[model samples]
Target: MKETSEKKAIIKKLMKEGKTYKQISEETGIHPGTVGIYGGKLKKAEREKKCFNGDRHLCKTCKYRASGARSGCDYIIHTGNERGCNPEVCNKYERGNRNETKTSSKGK
Candidate 1:
């Protein structure tokens, strides 16, 4: 209802301000879990946003491109235990086909 909307707005702002889940909860009177949930959504949005901030390569080439999703980069997603990397200035770029093993092994 209206109360939920108000809480959502506060959550959005706090998230944009980079407030921690516990901090947002204390300031907004929302539960820490709820703050974390909303914060996660907001953070995902900001991370996957296409940027013109000196990108050296397309996100598609980076392993953190979230290619498994149907919409490609609609939301930043994590693969395995690895956190998502920035498309604009990520120095730890890995290939998308990292899981594919070599089929031939010097059997000529």
Candidate 2:
């Protein structure tokens, strides 16, 4: 078995080469969840290295950030009512339609 550091390096290389999480898991025999963690760390390290010269906007403007229209802000209400607003603020704040039916139909 490879050392943890070696495994992490392999995961990073694979990720940089655009390999999917499932592909890395299949090649390294690591669980997909574990590979995801390693991949996240590797990406974070690379991003940090790139932004080392004081660029906080690196993360703030990330495509994965909630500020995008299709991001978490579209569906989640962070300030008004909902509680578990993990990101603290919702960039896409849309008014709720009280008359709209809920998506989930509980009783047939």
Candidate 3:
């Protein structure tokens, strides 16, 4: 109970400090696999939050925007092996439907 929370806190803190799973495991005596699991969860949560909150555009021109992607920017996400144009991928493409909803709601 208390020990579990403590371990989670330690893992999160170490992860925020840019420590790798192996390094965290070595320092905290937690298994590398366990550290990696927690790290993966944290990273997933962070990505979701970033996407939902919107992010800055990485480039002046985005391939996803140019190609008329509606769901969201898939510049790097949909790429199987080919490298994307911008080194940093952005998740802030304004979906047409979502924009319409926003505009309609504002009128009400």
Model 2 agreement with the true structure over 1-108: per-residue lDDT tens digits: 778888888898898799999999999898899899988877776765664322343334433334435443223232343434333332333344422313455786
- Return the TM-score for each candidate structure: 0.46, 0.46, 0.47
Error of 3 at 54 (Å): 9.8
User: lDDT per residue, candidate 1, 43-104, as tens digits?
Assistant: 66665565532334555565445434343332223433433544465555566652332234
What value of lDDT does candidate 2 attain over all alpha carbons?
0.59
Report the C-alpha lDDT of model 3 over 12-61, residue by residue, as the tens digit: 99999999899999999988888888888878778656653323333334
Give residue 38's error in model 3 in angstroms: 0.8
CA lDDT of each candidate?
0.60, 0.59, 0.60
TM-score, candidate 1, is 0.46
What is the alpha-carbon RMSD of candidate 2 to the true structure? 12.0
Q: 61, model 2: CA deviation in Å?
A: 19
Write down the worst ten-residue block by lDDT for model 3: 96-105
Predicted structure 3, TM vs. truth: 0.47
